[model samples]
Target: MSGRIAHLADVRGGYALEADAVVVGSGAGGAMAAANLARAGMDVVVVEAGPQVRPDDMTRDGPAFLSKYYWEGGLRMLLGSGAYPTMSGRCLGGSTVVNSAIFFRLPDWVRQAWIDEAGLSGLAGPELDAAYDRIFTRLKVAPTPMHVMGRKNLVTRDVLDRVGVPNKPLPRAVDGCIGSGDCLTGCRQGAKQSVDRSVLPEAVDHGARVMTCSQVERILFEDGRAVGVEGDVVDLDGWQKVGRFSVRAPRVFLAAGALHTPVLMQRSGVRLGGRVGGTFAAHISGLALGILPDDVRPWEGATQGWGGFSPEVQGLKFEALWGPTALIAAEWGGLGRDLSQMLQDVRRAAMVVMVYRAKTKGSVRATRSGMPDARLWIPPEEIHVVARQVHKLTAAFLDMGAEYVFTGVKGLPDRIRTIDEASGLLSNRLRGRHMTMTANHVFCSCPMDARADHGVVDPEGRVHGVPGLWISDASVFPSPSAVNPQATVMALSDLISRRAADLSLLDA
Candidate 1:
């Protein structure tokens, strides 16, 4: 249970903690496992590769920390068979700290869908619900108060009402949220109770040790069993060293997120049908932008308010999102002096919940032995549906008095000067440019029963060949739930951690 705060300059002669388990990636999944295992009196060591962002280190506005914490500078393009972007965070608490803090338990239908489609009976309705309740109680989640909806949520609510779309308040994990609305930037007020404030601290309290800035380069295996991990100490920036150290854990849990977990397994010489980085999705997300007349204060309210989907609504779904002044300014499309003018009006912008059913049309292939090359491209046919929903949603916003609309201005190839000109260039109107997007959720790569020929992990997130290695993150999400995935990930992870702890038999 004793370990040091891992930094870029740290090293070890052998397994320092030398205990029962080693958890790679101190995100939602790993933290949950560590908490359960440590509480059970198992010696647990949690390793992370990013700097620990403290309250003072927290910048209370914009997605300023986005570039700092996110992989690929928050511009990760998940090239579906069509093209788009999907970015994520890479800090100590990982993406959990940088997320919108909205916690939606897997809806009833999602669990049923997994059971019916992917054959994961273990994560069915009642059991999943019980797990959700446990994690929810542990995390102290609550709804975003109406009074704190801020200007953006208020305007979006009116817009949805006018369009006959129901907008509900979202539940978040924070306690005393005052609508600073910079959830993507990293919450500084200690208000957003992300994993750092919740599970990780709990794990630490239960005698778990966290090593920050320690980048795990690869999983080390001996005689086909996971013995430990190796990599280097990373600094504030995301850089790793060469010579690696090893730990000896009979149990190794890979929670390095969706993108890296598969790669890590592959590097460790474990091949479960070789579907390491395949079966990826990004919610095929598109942004909703509106140029309002009033000062909406982009940096107000919860970063993500609330949203739901409707078969009635076509390809896209609804979710309210608020941005900061800098991001709003960045989203403004134009050239030269005119762009400066739009940037000045950053206060008058509010965006809507927007996503079409993203396609599972890409793969994260190993670019080399230790690196991966993303082979993502969205489908062309889906763009019509994506654009249609966006157009309809924009109409609803315009009905609510939005003067100008810029659906994906940040993805636009060129800049538009006037609101009058924006109408001509919103949808298929895009430059056919493949932009990078990011979601905290990861799935399908290790699908339970895509058939053994292609799946990496089984329904229970256990590796097909490895004896004790298991995946409890979004990597095993058969298909994404239609909501922020924290609740689902935590619930699923909680379920798995309990199974790992039960130990009736270890090698499932």
Candidate 2:
């Protein structure tokens, strides 16, 4: 029997419910945890702050979708050396719904580092491998097929091949991707296997109840032990609090991502000596456009189907990027005529992006309005690192016989036509102020460590000093993953949640 789904309309004056466990944030981690616990026969309640949006309900309208489903209406940014946008979704299934569906397994070197340096011994054995297998199978993870890769991705593959750079099709959590090229807005075709469409429904089939439009404010405590959560039931249309709600449970799981998870912990009075919101890290990314002489119709391809890593570059990787025409044009800064011409020439545009793993840590705090205010400092050296990345991609395009490469670096020429020009342009003048940087994979705010004082959570994801409270999200990463975090997040959530279920049974 499928459990009930309660929306704002179903919630009256308020709601007071009880469950064996309550999971927050319905994204990758939360949905996975809920499914595991529910299958274990525990009564689970999944509370999400955003509305439940089905695939058919999704649209290609980027602005409208961002306003409704994204945090801070897609305007949330990191503040420090430069203002960099952090795109995180606020809808049910969270970022998995808006992400490009790319799946990269946790690197073996990163795993070894976790065991040796981070003291996460349990993450090494068959249990972690089993978790990866189950998730990969469940999501139907595979490489994007050639037919659906479209001309843009194919051209990128060709360019990398010609440059003697090893590249391949990106593995994605998708079943029947049509390459509509709007994965960021939302997958209207239901092809992308986001958690809401896969694991969350499986959880409901296991008799786990899902409560939408339910924003959890804080963890309820009884003598320093977590007992439940309390917050507002919000109206989705206006985003106004329509009623108050509470859920009493023996266990509470936090999967609210990196930015908001720290704020949530602080609000619940579970601050671990101000470490809850510190040590924030991210994979900072920037892009340069390759204006091809031939028409590639950038909008027709898979959003990001091909990518490569350079043997020379240690901390950065490259990918083919595309989106709505407006999003692509926004990368090129100009006046009316220039903008209009760029729009007209959109078909001749192919974008190459560089994602750099940030070395410096950042911080996240709750704003006066109770939203997450995140800040990260990109040092001048990292600025040069990003500039080097830009130089590489620009050079690749010039070698591919591109009509011109458009790099939006403030100090450089609008069109870089030669390798020498790009080298001289990006030699030393690039500063944080010259580029608009962004990151979607933000993590480590509530990092986990074996030592109690080193991080907010213990190795098992239990809050160091707060029993009955656990975090099963990227917030618990000891450090940056140096790749996309969704796969690692789900694997860790699976390990932690299954343990939680076993503990619940032992107590019973």
Q: Going through the candidates in order, what is the number of backbone clashes in each?
A: 24, 0
- TM-scores of all models? 0.89, 0.96
User: Judged by lDDT, which candidate is best?
Assistant: 2
lDDT of 1 by residue, 195-248 (tens): 877887777777777776666777767788777787766454334353355556
Residue-wise C-alpha lDDT for candidate 2, range 1-508, written one tens digit per residue: 5797787688746799999999999999999999989988999999998887766656777778778888888888888767888888888899999999888877787788778877899887788888888888999999988888888888778766655568999999998999998899888888999999989988999889999888889889998999889999888677788889999998999998998888988887777888999778888777778888888998897899998875666657778888766656555746776777776567888887877776866998877677888888777777788787777777778888787888777767787778777774456666666786677889989988998988888888899989899999999988788778899999899889989887331121
Model 2 lDDT on a 0 to 1 scale: 0.83
lDDT of 1 at 254: 82
TM-score of model 1 vs. true structure: 0.89
Candidate 1: which stretches are off by over 4 Å?
1-17, 60-64, 80-83, 237-243, 311-316, 369-371, 409-440, 450-454, 503-508
